[model samples]
Structures are given as structure tokens and as C-alpha cells.
Target: MTSGPQHPTPDTHACSAHPADPSMAPAPDAERCAHGQAFEILSTCHEHIGERLGALEEVGRALRDAPELEQQHLATLGEVLAFLDTAIPIHSADEEQSLFPRLRALPTFAGAVGDTPMDCMEAEHIEHGDEKARLKAAIVTRDAGAVGRHAIALANAYRSHIAKEEEVLYPMARQLLTDPAAIADMTEEMRARRREAGLLKC
Candidate 1:
């Protein structure tokens, strides 16, 4: 290890203002595998999702506080909507095809996986889709009150959903899946899916 101010002692403890999922990381050598790199992509998306949620919350607060929002505030809303439109299907597709299948294959997590965080998250995603549609409608109508209420609800919903994914789902997926070969296959699947969805570069 290079000795510098950058390297903290092993025993050093620091407070983190943000919630992070350590499970999303792979072992040092495992990073050579495409699945490990895919996790990195997913982690980036997680951060992106968090940012959009914050923007939505801020816009909702503005809408509720005042009837007339500045063009900048509306621009923020537009950005949030664009992010959601791009992220929701892709993120969910990855989970549905890759993570959930591997999770279901694990006997240890059978009932717990079905009933605990996955169940909660799936329900929230459905509700989130509905809320997003409503928000778009509200935006079209220029209904500030509708937009405000939907934004508040969506913010709360996303916060809960992301928390469960971070705290429970990602950890369980990491613990259950250990076959390097299988993860490699999953990574290829993610890549292919991305290409099919026009989410990947040629």
C-alpha cells in the first residue's frame, strides 16, 4: 500500500452522510469478470437514481410552497422525469432477469427472498409507474397541486424502494450467488439486453 494521507488506518472509523451498499462490490480479483464490471454500472445507476429522487423532492417542495414555480424548477422536474423514464425499465429489467433468477435459485433465501424485500420492492415499482404516469398527466395539465402531491408520494416511494434494494436485496444477492461462471453469463445477458434496448454503444 502506498503510504500517504489518502490511506486511512484499518481501525479508522468515519461517519457517512450517505447510505451505501457494500454488497454491490466484488472481491478484488473478481473484478476481472464482466459481472463485476456490470455491478459497477449498476452502482452508477443507483447513484443516478438517488440524484433524481433528490431533485424530485426539491421540486415537490417548491411546488407545494408556491403555486408558481420558476422555469428552472420546472427544468429540474423535466430532468427528473427523463431520468426515471430511462432508468426504471432498464434497472428493473436487470433485476428481473439477472438478480431475481439467481436469488430464486438459492434455497436459503427462498421464502425470505420472495416475501421480504423483493415483494415490497416489486409492489413499489408498480405504484411508482402509476405515480409517474399521473405526474406526466399533471405536467401536461399544468396542475401544480397534482404535481406537488405526486412528487411527494414518488419521493417517499423511491426512498423506501432504494433503501430496501440497498439494505436487503443487494446484500442477499451477493451472499447467495458465488458461481463465477454463472455471474459471467449474467453479465453477458446484461450487455445483450442493453444493446437490444439501445442502451449500449456499438
Candidate 2:
């Protein structure tokens, strides 16, 4: 029962190795029992996201206080961007490609969560990309005002977004993903997704 870090590093490994491509066929029950592990992976990802959001807010404050973007501020912003640019897609695939689809397929599951919540989550995922682009552009251009504006918005949006998943979606997953084969396949797909993204080694 290894666990992920409470606060991940700048270069957190996004992928996890699995027995095989769970997408191809359901693995044996003995090998497919990682539902709790899957939840832990997502929990670790959120912890990293929350920490980075705080850092982004601090970057916003620096931009607001200074007349011009300092070199240090730029460097910090670049690191934040790099982390999110890599991490967000990997996280999204964990949800959209693996988690959400699994939850959606369970007939009993929808009554508890409904379609709207999942739909909203997907929409926010897209908005995250848009906000990240805006922030990147603002940082590249050294437009402190735009950077600050988008940073605050992105942080706020994610805060709300993550809250919903933590409160509703993940709990639902824990209850429903008890089947050994399903859990194995879902967890394997999660690893495969990050591997495809070149996240590498976990």
C-alpha cells in the first residue's frame, strides 16, 4: 500500500506501470484490485494542484505589487505554467478517459450523480485549457495585469472544480468501482494515459 506524496515535486511522475493494457482485455481478478490506489493517485494530483494554485496566487500578488515583472517572478510563473501544462492533461485523462466513463457506464451510478454534474466537470476541463493559454500568453508578454487577472480566475475556477470532485465524484467512484476487473482496467487505463502523454515512471 504505497501512497503518493502529499505535495508533489515540480517533476512529479504522472504515469504508473500496470500488468498490461487494461483496455485490450480485463485482467485477472488478482491483478485488477487497485480501486483504492486509483483514488489515491487522484488525491495526490489534487494536492499538487492546490499547492500550485497557491503559488499562482502568490505570483499574482507579486505582479500586482511591482511596477514591472521581475526576473524571479517570471521564472516562478514559467515553472507554474510548465507544471500545469503537463499535469492538467494527465489529470484530465484520469477523469475523462478513465474515471468518468467508468462511472457513467454504471446504471445505478447516474441516479446518485446525474449527467449534469459530469457534464459541468468536462466543460470546466476545457475551460482550464483556455485559462492556461491566457495565463501563458500574459506571462510571455509580461502583461502583469492580464496575468494577475487570469491567474486569479484560474485558481478560483479550479478551487470550485476540485471541491465538487472531492465532495461528490470521487466518493461515488469509491462506492461503485469495487469490482476487481473494473478497478484493474480503470487503473491500468489511467497509467496508460499518462504514459502516452510522456509523463513517465511512477
Candidate 3:
């Protein structure tokens, strides 16, 4: 990771506004898996998202005590906002458009679980979008108190959402979505999406 300016700039990379913090950088393996393996790419996204959620919580706590947005806080908040605006939508598409549909198509998927996990996951995605809108509004208004409140709320909700995917959905995906052709198609689709979004180098 490279250090960014004190103020946020519109950069292409998702975390381009942050300082050189190793913890805030995406996993190196994630870059390699970006265009190759669908499950690996999605799992790596979850890892990156988990890291950002932690950062969000930390910034929220700092904002609560600080009189105003400090330079570092501003940079961190910029990174978080950039991530929410960019990476999150792509990740959701990877799940909702690619993974979830395949999982739903599985013969074992319909009744194996009493309720549709995909429905729950999709609902939560919508809720997260709503929460993000609130957080962004607070940031725009320079309302430190509201920013802190909404940031923590978004982080907590995301953590729970990630937990459910990791604990329940992903495992099921790995087991049931086993056809090589299907996996290849999913990987290509994910790669195409990133390439089209200019997030992929190759």
C-alpha cells in the first residue's frame, strides 16, 4: 500500500486514499486469483471486506473522541467510502449474479435448506446499501456524531453478513457447485466484470 494525500482524491484503486498500512492492503493472493478462480476470488473479497470493516469500526471509535476529522481519519474514511462505492457492488454481483444463481440451481439447493439462504443474503445486501447511503450522507454533512454512529452500525451489520456467507453459503457453494464447466464459466464472468470495470490489469 502507498500513502495517499491528507485529503481524498478520486483514484481508481478502491483503497487509494489510505496510508501505507499493510493491514489495509488487499491480500496479495487476491490479486493473483482475480481472473482465475471464482470461489477463490470471492473468498479473497470477503477477506478484504473483513479488513475494511475493522478499519471502519476503528475510524468510528476515533471520530467519537476527536473534535473533528483529523487528517488520518479523513484519509481512512476516504478509503472506506471508496471501497463501499466501488468494490462492494462488484462483490455483491459476484455473489448475486454468479454464485447464488448457481447454488440456487443445484438439485440439493431447493429443499435441503428450509428457507432460501440466497433470499436472506439478497435481502441483507439491500439493507447494507441502505446503511451505506446513511453513512455517506453523514460524512457529506460533516456530522461527526452521525458518522460515528452510522459507520459502526454499517461495520457491525457487514461483519454479521460476512459471517453468514462464510459459515453457511460459501461452504454450500464449494460443495454443490462442483461442475468444472460451470466453475470455468463463473470465473470468466467474474473476470469479465472486473475487466469491464477497469479493475483488472490482465
Provide TM-scores for the models.
0.74, 0.74, 0.80
The segments of candidate 1 whose C-alpha lies over 4 angstroms from its true place after superposition are: 1-36, 109-116, 200-202
lDDT of each: 0.65, 0.68, 0.74
Q: For residues 56-103, write the lDDT of model 3, one tens digit per residue.
A: 999999888767766797789899888777888888898989997887
Q: What order do candidates take by TM-score, descending?
A: 3, 2, 1
Top candidate on TM-score is: 3
Which candidate ranks first by lDDT, i.e. highest?
Answer: 3
* Between candidates 2 and 3, the lDDT winner: 3
Candidate RMSDs in order? 9.9, 12.9, 13.7
Of the candidates numbered 1 and 2, which has the greater lDDT value?
Answer: 2
Q: List, residue by residue over 1-202, the lDDT tens digit for candidate 2.
A: 9974332111111111122211111112322222336776676677667777888888887677567778888887878788887888788888888887776676553454543455667878898889888988887888888888888888877776776677666766677667788877877887676657765421
Q: Which stretches of model 2 miss by more than 4 angstroms?
A: 1-36, 109-114, 196-202
Candidate 3 wrong stretches, greater than 4 Å: 1-26, 111-114
Native-to-model Cα distance after best TM-score fit, residue 76 in candidate 1, in Å = 1.8
